[model samples]
Target: MPTAIIAEDEDLLRSELRRMLAECWPELEVLAECEHGADALEAIERLQPDVAFLDIRMPGLSGLDVAHAVSGRCHAVFTTAYDQYAVEAFAAGALDYLLKPVAKARLEQAVTRLRERLRLSETAPDIGRLMAELDRRLRPQVETEQRIRWISASVGDTIKLFPIEQILFFESDEKYTRVVSGEDEAHVRKPLRELVAGLDPEQFWQIHRGVVVRAEAIARARRDELGRITVELRGRPERLKVSQAYAWRFKAM
Candidate 1:
């Protein structure tokens, strides 16, 4: 039986993919399920599964990063929530791309293609072109005028609006995100990923999978002897952990 691994950040989505796979490819053996890109990379290296289903956006090493590092060691199918630009890029590059909320028919089609490739002993797809396209799409483009100005969060039964200037950081908490400003904190139904899309990337930096801190509020970034990176925010007691994928942001500092 062919072995495969699924890498996705959202628990529900990961589980759903597993369920769909079981239904479509009953003979296929799922070797592992990973919640982040770092873990997914480790699993892929160790297991050397026949195929890997990678989510494009992840905490540490993103799916594209994993694919680039692996260098076509195993067949890869990318899952993305990117817009038309990325879709067009994937189509032009002839890369296997699955849209988020993966449809059963589409997955079945992917499975058929994988089976044929495996049966014929075909080489892995050329990921270099896909990586180049991804790099182009993911480049940080400034959107100065559209930055968020106010955040409305739920504080118990009442709703409170906090100006963007007063906010210090946003931390993911299960289904909701905790917005922190000075000594006050409130919860919002929005996830960190969605919030990051609207927030100015120059102003707010995502340090970890679940943490986004304001650039001006950050006092300093410290690295321990072990090479672990952490950021200390101004007037905040807690230090935020920085994932390896985003550590490049503090390279100069």
Candidate 2:
């Protein structure tokens, strides 16, 4: 019997999927159900289930994020609603996908495919190219939804709301995003990726894996002694490294 785990944000959908799995695939044991990507990643790391039914989008980490974290640990069956890009990627990868409100017929088909692959003794499904394509198609959609308007931070017991425009940069350290405004900085609970979405791209540019700087605050770009490019912020000497992949963002600087 294959052990499976479900990772989804919505409680109703998670329960419904569990009920459907019980009715349709009785042999598969549901080892766990996670409500967010961070929790799901930890669960998958611990359980090491044979199948993971992951919702494509979630607050913390995406289903794809979980998949990337647990690469080759188990088969990934993505559950998404109206994400045609991910659906097509699943089809292309020869992996299974359960559309939201998971139709019985589709679920059955997915089970059949899973069984066939098991019988064939396939070691792992190749999902790299498929995931890349899905990211490409959904990047714009993700960016559109990542607008930061009101920011809530706290100095002590009292909370404060700072307009997004007041932020000069975002720095990631120890899994926390630190918002910087000139010399003043404050900590926020949101992760770097989450903060990136909430920020305006025209104003913020991710210059490094750990740093996203305000575009208007860029003072200049210069190559270091090691031939690596780094950016300096206006009126600030804190140099931020620019990865080659994201160097295009500072091309005009």
Candidate 3:
């Protein structure tokens, strides 16, 4: 029986994939479920699983990096977002991949191919061509992605434009998104999800589903007795909750 490992950052997606894999390939024993690529790589190296399902974009090491490192040792099935350019790149390079919100039919096809590869005792294919293609196609978008330089939020009756650098953190309330900077705070009609795309990932990190904090503003992270981490800010009184999915960011290596 072929053993497998699952590596995805999101808890919900990882669980859904595990559940689906049981239904589609019951004989495929799952060795581990990892929250990040680093753990996935470590698990792969230690267990030597025959198949690995990896998410493309993760907190530390990317799925592509893990695949590159383990090219000849295991079979890789990439899980990526629904980007046409990335899909085209995967198709062009003949790499196996599943899109986010994976359909059962597509997953079954991927499973079939992997089973065939295992039957033939074939090693995983190298991904240089795919990486180069992704670098060419996605570089422009990543460069221009951080377009929100100034946040125009409402400060009571007056609308204030706060520089992106000035923001300490962003938290979503019931409806409005609260923008906090030191002692000052403002409300925005926009949701945190809509605002996340324009923020530079290097500068702002999504610690929680409803919380995004400026990296510089974080003083430290403290894990409580329950193993829950809350991030302390440099100047802010309120600490941010680090969700289980993102807890890998603060794990000590």
> Which candidate leads the pack in lDDT?
1
Off by over 4 Å in 3: 1-144
Model 2 weakest lDDT span, ten residues long: 85-94
Worst 10-residue lDDT window for candidate 1 reads 85-94
TM-score for each of the candidates: 0.53, 0.50, 0.54
Off by over 4 Å in 2: 87-94, 122-253
Q: Quantify all predictions' global Cα lDDT against the true fold.
A: 0.77, 0.72, 0.77
* Candidate no. 2 TM-score: 0.50
Error of 3 at 26 (Å): 15
Tens-digit per-residue lDDT, 1-253, candidate 2: 7888999999999999998888888998999999988788788889988888888778766676566556547778888885443522342232566668899878877777666555444443775665556434432232135367877878889787767787778889776788888757788888886676556656777666578888888888998677578888887768888765355554554
**Clash numbers, per candidate:** 0, 2, 0
Query: What ranges in model 1 sit over 4 Å off?
Result: 1-36, 39-54, 57-61, 64-79, 82-147
